[model samples]
Target: MIFRSLADIEALERTPCEQAIAARTTYGLIERAARLHGARDAFVYLPDGELDTAPQRITYAELLANVNRAANLFRSLGVGPDDSVAILAPNIPSTQYALWGAQVAGRACPINFMLQPEHVAGLLDAANAKVVVAFGEHAQLDVAGAVRRIPGIEQRQVLWVSAPGAPTPALSQRANEAVFEQALAAQPDSLQFDPRLSPERIASLFHTGGTTGAPKLVQHTHGNEAHTSWFAHMFYGFDENTVEINGFPLFHVAGAFVYGLAMLAIGATQVLPTVLGMRDAAFLRNYWKFCEREKVGALACVPTILAGLCNQPVDADIASVKVAYTGGSPLPTELADRFEKATGIPVRNILGMTECSGLVSIEPLHAPRVPGSAGLRMPYSEVKIREDGVVALRGPHVSPGYTDAARNAGMFEDGWLVSGDLGRIDAQGYLHVTGRAKDVIIRGSHNIDPQLVEDAFLAHPGVAMCAVVAEPDAHSGEVAMAFVTLKPGASIAGDALLAEVAPRVYERPAIPRRVVVIDTLPVTAIGKVYKPALRLRAIEIKLQELFASQADGREIVVTAKERGSAAVADVRIAGAEDPALAARLQAALGAIAVPVAFSFS
Candidate 1:
């Protein structure tokens, strides 16, 4: 069905989802696809992410068989329905086998390999991982070294995987360690045991939020995953003939479920870039050529990628490309418009969360781009804006809750998942996300949304990316501060740029007090702007400005660090300790939001 609007989605919902979709589990969905399109190409892996390199293709039948073999192998290693299998690898064909195979046998936990060793260990311990499938030694990432650093990794079953034709790294002999290819080859090409798969069974455990404190492992039931994949497939009008470029890492929800499983469930071919994925410079430089060669129908990317693609010349034929899907962060209107004008491809925004199995709403490919809207909710799903403007959702696609029930307090209310995003449901059933509730800056009694300030700056042609964060204030609790990255060859002073964009911001209090220009903005692994680092930088700037007058041939050094949940700033004065100066600095900083610690050396 081609979903043009919310009405189209509602029309399809008249028939219950259970009646509409025969497959109730991810395994069932894949099995059904294999039966229908067994000979079709399921995945096309680019070995070196080069257009000239010959790609390795896997058929649906081979994919299902490998999944079955991996499941059987896991069962032999003592994995039960309740146990979890952890996979630490990039986007690879074998990673897909381990992910689905683990789900068939038990639950799968795909860990972010970019995380620190301690954080990775914490996630493994939290998920109670029985088996770990890690990528072998490579030039870029030290997967083996990170796995070895895990406290009790030696006791767990470890299977190593390498890219096609890549040499497998040798590891110290351990009773529990084995090469994944050799182990998987020994297993039969069919299921050895009945999984007794059910809709309510946990399919995977996905980690969300920052990896600083306790890890938040979101539990996705088979029903949650199956519904989301099916809804996305139907919404985007994907079929066996669709070929898409999927460069997102396996650990992210967008890669694992939204764009990954959704395409596989329909037997659509997914072209995976090299282990570096979109980060590979050579691949990005020749992205259009790859698309033309592959005849890609759907383009998967984030906002940052769109901005980069805007700079890349359209050096090849891209008439086959129909749509570009972008999420992981708010889509800047300027970037979207520029991309569409450059490549003539419509950019659809997606609103998703780990708790929702990767989807809440997606702009249908059949629908025109809405300026600020995140598009309509999934068919048969419920999305309502709270009185306070926070978006709430409830449906089969929504996860039950995190593994740690305590973490679900503010997020989950009864059956509705309280999305922390501040948004409004338009009269047309469109969701327009304004900003995050926690991202709001408070100045005295007035509350300001950072997006307003960011939008104002982004309206300028010189600004490439902008992030507005809360800066500590003496009188008011906090104020807005903006950090921006200029376009290539664009040069403008911070004060002049701020003056040019300040008029665009309607709210006076929402205007940023200071503007900082940098070569690039801090972003997460998936390309979303990281605001925590910006907030810390703002705090340091405010403190440095406050204490600049006290420097009498004494170097004043300011550093900020997150202590538990609060941000603490340390100020070091280079000289003999002066009680008066310290007292003044402490009093001045105490009035600010972040706590300040004074040290003289």
Candidate 2:
């Protein structure tokens, strides 16, 4: 049941994918579940604002029947294997069926509904999407405009799904788009599903961030998805009696694959929240009450949601929750400990990325957790840290590289997927993620890891969350800067909090020179800290201070030259009133002299 070493992992695999998929193809799994558990409820669409309406439920057999109908409709639109069926919709039962239907006929590609039209257009083009399924309206975004902007897509290629109670949009009046239910109503209840799909045939298209800029479209095969689902089953001990409430958005890989698709894959029931999930104040306000009412056995979670829920008071500990798995970012030790104490549900902080399908490792549900570690590598996968400490993995679950050939270089080497995360395998073989290798701050000759600095701040009793980033310094080349948030109603001042943590830092160069207290840290859809934005803010604040402290009060021009992880500042001084301007600047940068030089404007 547990793998303590690589040998134990190897012993668990018999002919790997061959035996793994012997009884279950991705679509075949659906057929087996429907036939086996025809009467069992597979999904329940809980109301958002209208609690007066009863939750709409779907049985396994009904789900498969609808998926088949939807699949036939997709085929009528020329969707086939390797073809992309782009999805843009909120978390709804029909959207879930559309996901399964798309995969039954072709690859499923769900774009973040929050994306701009241009971003959606790029994703559609990248996938060479044949069709797009989207909602008619949304409160925060223009779904119609995004659909319009996908290059070369016709109205006929768009399938518009309606909201729960909203009247169907007049798709017929518009020549370009069609109503989803109307199109599916025209198709027969059953459509032939090809059971001959090779494990290597692509099953889904998901985008992950690039080192320099644009996101890369990751290719996950049926084999990749199925393997991870099986891992989820084994890791969580999922069974037909299992009921899970998924809060992640449907478009996210974690939601589409793990919480939604994977839940169905295991023949378990899924309960959806109202439109907005974690952000829905009503939902968050009544989360514990809802869980108790629904008999939620395992809650799919992220650190952000877990942190938010921890702030809300709990009346009593509910013993029904088996475990709450959180991934997509580092889980602070304090947050995990606090959450368990508050609600009695263990947070299994997980580690994975889009490129690796979903999850590679997570805290063992039954074992003692490492305070700051993600967990041991899953039995289906193998992980190694590169010489530079970047966690690298080799597994059947790992995607077959990205579609963009330009992004493959240095991204994968030999058989290992080169994760950008900097981490180390502990003596016990648990993976402890340190920080991103590229996000380090270089002070003179010393490299300061931001996570180390962040950990120092998180230890403060008042600090709820924190992010440490590199700021360009006129003296020390670069200095570590921290942005932090406090526990609700905690009134600790910024400088006082910094003083408490500064001496606690192991090294002088590693200590953050600047600390800014903010209400909250910017988070990605998947709940990870958005660090690139933090890095940009750090540079702006550091440069503004440099411009203010010119000893001669002279006009100066400054530019940043980034070499490796270091941020180098070149200052040009003109009409300098004091000869000690350069010296004064050097003294002000940091305690240690930076790799700074001066010139005339």
Candidate 3:
């Protein structure tokens, strides 16, 4: 099933998804792989993320046995088909066991442990987690401390997992807590009860990382995960011989399903970098060497990692590498071209969302790169660009809705899940994502695409990463502003950089009003530029400039933060409050989208 175009995908779908995919559940899929490729390596884990380090290998049969043991352990802990088992860990083998095992026993809820304890607690509470599988204390992250902080967590069964050779952190003895290895070892190495596997049964609850609101938990059915993983494996042209380097965190769909489970379903080996994953600087430095050593046939990464790889020297025999896949953020045309030119491996783009089990479209390995295109939609999936340019998709891969039905209002329309991304389908069926619908900069009545400004800035050789956001403006409601980070050893004045790139932005309104150069752009755990933070910075800057004259020697401080799902700007005055000045400031700030609050010191 070498998917070269939409026609190939359509041809495959002609058999019907139910008939095409033999295994409908994650557990069933792994069982099939284990039966077919029992001796094949399923995973190669690099403990220290070093090329010379001795790696831990797990065979397909071994992996399936571990999954069964973990599932039995969870079921023994009273986790039912409707119960949720929450996991807080990095990219360790135990994390994978917990993820798939919980899916077999109950619903797996993989939370971002990097989030604050209160936020994590909220997610756990939302999912009604009955058991928690968390990592023990590590130097990089205080997972143990976070777990202890979760209110009422002591009431639920807690299993702590520690990497081999890592010391267990001492904590107050709790009756509900137990060592994960000890508990898992006690369980049978096979399923003790029927899974009652069904396509409609909820398999997992994935928290969506929205910019403003409390994160929404997406419900992925067994069918959703099965379809997405199968299609991704087909599109990537993966077989038992395919080996990919996957460092993405398990909490993300790209890591758990797209790049992770997709490879595992076919007994393809996935090289897990380390517990820290891609964030380990040393591992990134030796990424190519490790790939060369593993004979990796496919490279799994995000656009940010790909951009960094462009700077890293390919000092190893990477002849086995056929192609590199990147997603998570918009793939800049310039960045992709530069990487492909620097390394002979072709760079393919993937467009995904949590709602669709992390996949929507992927550029087939056999297809040539299409500039500015995210690639073709999944097989048997319907992708339509609304009149307003919002991409909407309906397919077996699509999740039913969010755990909180209210959050699905604008997201899930009819049977289609609105992507919130502005895109167009070409005559050839390629989807070119122009920009985020919400990210569009509005000036007066004109709408400006931020990608236009970002692409212009990225064209400069000195720029490493560039993000364009809307800055609050009293005159035009909001105007475009660019935040850029320069490449290593590259130096240029912000004004000079703007002067050089402004003309390249064809749209007058799309041209950024100002450019700010920073040492590094704030990014998410997965390295996508955190635009909400930049937007807040932009709003704070505008507020400071707007109130500077009105301060009249009184110290003026402006701070911005998300209040509930709304962005709020807090203005503090040094002296006693003056009603006249407060009224004036309130009237001026009212023009902006963000709500403004006044306070006096």
| Regions of candidate 2 where Cα sits further than 4 Å from its true position | 1-11, 14-17, 20-24, 49-53, 140-142, 149-156, 170-172, 193-196, 210-212, 549-601
Which digits, one per residue and each the tens of the lDDT, describe model 2 over residues 34-67? 8888888888777563345577788999889888
lDDT of 2: 0.76
Cα lDDT of model 3 by residue, 1-601, tens digit: 7889888888997796888885888888899999999999999988886676799999999899999999999998899998999999988888899999999999999998878777888998899899999999887767888888888787888889887557874545888888887788898899999989899999999998653457889999999999889778777888999999999889999999989889888889999988888888889889889988999999888877887888899999999999999998889888888899899999999999999999999988888999888999998899999998899999999999998898889999999999999999998899999999889888999999888778888789999889999998878988999999888899999899999998899688888888999998888878788898999899888889878876677888999998875689899988887888888877777657778788998
Please give the CA lDDT of all the candidate structures. Answer: 0.89, 0.76, 0.88
Q: Which stretches of candidate 3 lie over 4 Å from their true place?
A: 169-171, 576-580, 587-590
lDDT (10s digit) by residue, model 1, range 224-296: 9999888797678778899999999888899988899999888899999888888889899899999999999
Using TM-score as the measure, name the better of candidate 1 and candidate 2.
1
TM-score of 1: 0.97
Higher-TM-score candidate of 2 and 3: 3
Clashing pairs in 3: none
